[model samples]
Target: MALAQFAREYRTVRRAEGWGSLDGAYYRHLPFQDLTGRFTDIWRIRARSYHTFLHRVLAPLESLTGRPLNVVDLGAGSGWLGYRLARRGHWVAAVDLLDDVLDGLGAVRHYATPVRPLLAEFDHLPMPTGHLDLAVFNASFHYSTDYAKTLCETLRVLRKQGTLVILDSPMYRGPTSGMRMVQERQARFLAKYGFASDALPSEHFLTPARLDVLSTELGIAWRLHRPGLDWRSSLIRAIGGIRARREPAQFPVIVGTCPS
Candidate 1:
């Protein structure tokens, strides 16, 4: 029953956002998305973030461990990131609540390499203890109803020395700015779709203090790695902040590892 409601809300937002044109090929070339398509420019910025994950986190882990890491991509919409990871020879579990062929677990079939698809929630992953070397919340952690549980659950499946990553989630310096961004987003959604799209409980955006708290509570150390921002991105952010009357959010790849 809950899954049905969640699917309905997910479909409503996807249709309202006009993502019908995003097919398998579109997901295939993510980060390097279509130049003329909607949200291409946003994905342009996200490419830097993804590269940061590659250079700063994944590369180092690979060099240190000297083997293909077992990875789980949480909230793997369309399984693009997982497909990419699997193509790199790492085993990947593409997990999401949505099973829609184009934007969900079912989309894993589009890729040539093998990727395990699982329909599961963040708070209760279907993986065995100490089974994975890395767990990544691919633009998905902020949507967690309870981040503490979600993080703990993810860590549960991972070996004690395993790493966890939060990729491409809008993060702010403080709660106030994050809340303001949420208000503006909700207003836009209400105006456009006659709904706030907050039907489900979610943390929405993250803050450093929040991560610090999570770190202390969960016995993990987290580092915020900011992807390089170009001049145009800074200028746009400045203008957008003035127009929105609140500070703009930044997407940083937050990486963490627990002690053995």
Candidate 2:
């Protein structure tokens, strides 16, 4: 009940931000989807990052086997990545709280592949124990109000030595910087939308210390890989650092292995 309520509010904020575009076909194409309007550059960046995720993470893992993988996509907005996996013959469960046709799990119908859509919370995944080979929080982990609880729940469903991925979440060098980013974001949303857009008690960012704690508690070893940003983004971040005199948040593809 709480999950559904939080997701509906999140959807409202996303709609206000223009991400809930009515074009369902656009989202079905996913990382291969074309860009439009004010969010063009942002979508382009996301596409590039997703390709990096594919190259540095998925491709290599896929190469390791010829058989289909048992995979789960947590917070699978629009079911794009899940569709991609399902098309490749992997057994996939696409989980999310939103089932809206335009921008949520219901958009999975736009894809031809048979992706199993499950409307559920990430922390309390409706999956069998020790059955999944891969569990990916695609651009979604930072939305968790409790990272430890979420990961623990994920760990319970993962097979021994199964991999879990944290993709596209903003990771700062420290908690202070992360908090600043969160505050700034909240302020912008509050001013622009008459509310902070924090409909849930999400952590909203990540730090090394936080990751370290997860590693310790989950008994998992994490490998961090920072895929390169575009030259313009690189320059902009550099300029912003010079002016703001602070470290920019990074999107590192963080992969953690479940204990054997």
Candidate 3:
């Protein structure tokens, strides 16, 4: 079945079986690191540094939409991306499964208006049609139980020519026993619930091939950047430089727009 159709079907079935409740509890119950704020700080620092070296690669989008951008950050834990986009005068909304993450980001101040957080499932976005200029998935796509469905809904709600930027770690197989065990565990959960398609860690991470599939399905053009070692080191060196770009970066950001 097509991804959108499958997602609608799965969501219906899951909702009927009370499976949606499990995701809410699972994300909410995770043991956050003691230095919770630090993680967000690190993410911001790295992201800014990457922009320094690769801004050339990413800057075109800014010009494409000359006016203030309306952005939505999905899985916006701590609102790092939302805060940054808002700082650049973008009207931003930060969405997440857990309310605590939204509460914690309340302290974040940006140039644009303070963000509004919406609590909703990935498969079921809480927005109207043609509402957003951009939607971002930052390092959290893999955690999505129904990524295909989520992707379709994201496209449905986006305005014609609106962009969807997914930043995620690529999927990989592991050699270590512990890693294999984790993979097995992930597989079991997915099979039991029909929640995911692949067992690789980055199953939700769109590879070039997968990107092609999504592009065709959603009718969006896609571009990818794989950061290099020097780019990665430079980003780490400067933390949050005013303007920078890097290769060999921590994660890849997939940027594409819906067809007009």
Top of the candidates by lDDT: 1
Task: List candidate 2 stretches off by more than 4 Å.
Answer: 1-5, 20-24, 239-245
By lDDT, the candidates rank as 1, 2, 3
**Rank order (by TM-score, best first):** 1, 2, 3
Model 2 lDDT tens row, 1-260: 55566776677778776674566567665675554464665666677777777788777778886678899999898888888888878999999888888678888877788889998988788888998989999889999999999999999999888889988899988887778778878897778767786768899999888889888987989988877777887777678666655678788889998899
TM-score of candidate 3 relative to the true fold: 0.60
Q: Name the regions of candidate 3 deviating beyond 4 angstroms.
A: 1-58, 101-113, 172-204, 231-250
- Candidate 3: tens digits of C-alpha lDDT, residues 1-260: 34444434444443444321212232232222212342443344345434642363335667877788777878775565576666677788887655442232332332134777776656788788889877887666765655566788888778887777766544332223224434554576476766543332334433455567777876788766544435655556455222222212235555676788
Model 1 error, position 199 (Å): 1.5
Judging by TM-score against the true structure, name the best candidate.
Answer: 1
Clashes of each: 0, 0, 13
- The model with the greater TM-score, 2 or 3, is 2
Question: Candidate 3 — what's its lDDT?
Answer: 0.55
C-alpha lDDT of all candidate models, in order: 0.84, 0.82, 0.55
Q: Using Cα atoms with residue i matched to residue i, what is each candidate's TM-score against the true structure?
A: 0.94, 0.92, 0.60
